[model samples]
Target: MTTIDPGAELKARIAEIKERFAIESAGGKLTVRRDDGLYRHLEVEMPKSSAYWFEVMTWPGALAITGHTGSHIFRRDEDMLLFFRTCMGPGPDWKIDTRYWAEKVQPDGIGSTGVQSYAEDRVKAYIKQAAQEAEADHPGLLAEVEEELFSRYSKADLETEAGAKAALAAFEFDGFRFDTAGWEFTEYDYWFLYTCQALAWTVAQYDARVQVAA
Candidate 1:
């Protein structure tokens, strides 16, 4: 049997991410260390001027960012990228908070994510959770659902009451039915799906500015 190596995949992805961002061109530094050929740790230091400095570090499942203002730990790459993106720019809004995901660097009660978008992300997370929980209560239910949907995902949507009802409506087999009326969405940071391209433009802009100043 051939074994697929997740660490190898992650190494390639991380390398691709760095190349896509072109961090060095912006006078930023991104360094990585490997263990037994598996990409393991990462550290990032954005170009520092009198007004700004930021850093990012990651290991295994955890990622952290720090700025002059504050720092935070993040589990989701989307959250990390979006927050970091928030701090790169030309003015008050661009200042790094602590880690420089330094996003909007808003005080409590302020957020960079849009209201509807935040709600949607919450709904999606809630649904995925509900599906997993329901499956735990009814083993093999998810396998059946996956078979029906022809998707390889481990779970299904079931966050809102309406969505839960829709899930019930979608599949009914003998004694199989999804019960998710009581599932509740947990609110948290609103983050976007991350891509290196999402951050490349800002890096390019920063690099150009530094070059002109030089």
Candidate 2:
């Protein structure tokens, strides 16, 4: 079996997206149009950290051009390209910091003190489902995933309660108002694992698209 280099594959995918969609950027905004002439405008906001957040609005009407909007945050340029590709396809419904984590950590009817417990329960549930799927479908890819994880995060960094709190602090973003101090150490580790899973799934989706086009 051939080992997949995610960095190289991501670069190629980004290039293909630029060529196929005629993506253009100017004055902090990236723009692209669909084959049907619907246009998407992405406004990016760069924070002090390397991660950038974006809000995208799409317009379908020729005269009025009214459509919905969505937002996402990406830690790298390659992630932004994958975001664009997913937008062109089914339109991404996932909002990492704002929607997903917020809902998990602060579900409806939950008070402040319940946040950690709620998040822990949800993470535990997700891990069980994720492990089953990973074992069944992609056992061969686990080592590569682990290597990528270690490159981004130290084992020591994820093993302790203090490290878990620090990881949450480092990854905190605007519009995601939460108290990381309340989060359990296991929750932090699960968050990192979940992020890696999401990234791998996105790359797989992009690869599938490429194969279908070919």
User: For every model shown, what is its TM-score relative to the native structure?
Assistant: 0.26, 0.19
Q: How does candidate 1 fare on TM-score?
A: 0.26
Instruction: Put down candidate 2 lDDT per residue, 1-214, tens digits, no spaces.
Output: 1132333543554445333322211122222323222343433332322343333333432111111112112322233444434443443332233223323222233334121222333332332333344544555433433342234554425444455445434532222222433222333232332332233333344445546769
Worst 10 residues of 1 by lDDT: 187-196
Which candidate number would show the highest TM-score if scored against the true structure? Answer: 1
How many clashing residue pairs are found in candidate 1? 10
Error of 1 at 90 (Å): 14
Error of 2 at 95 (Å): 24
- Backbone clash pairs for candidate 2 read none
Candidate 1: Cα lDDT at 141: 66
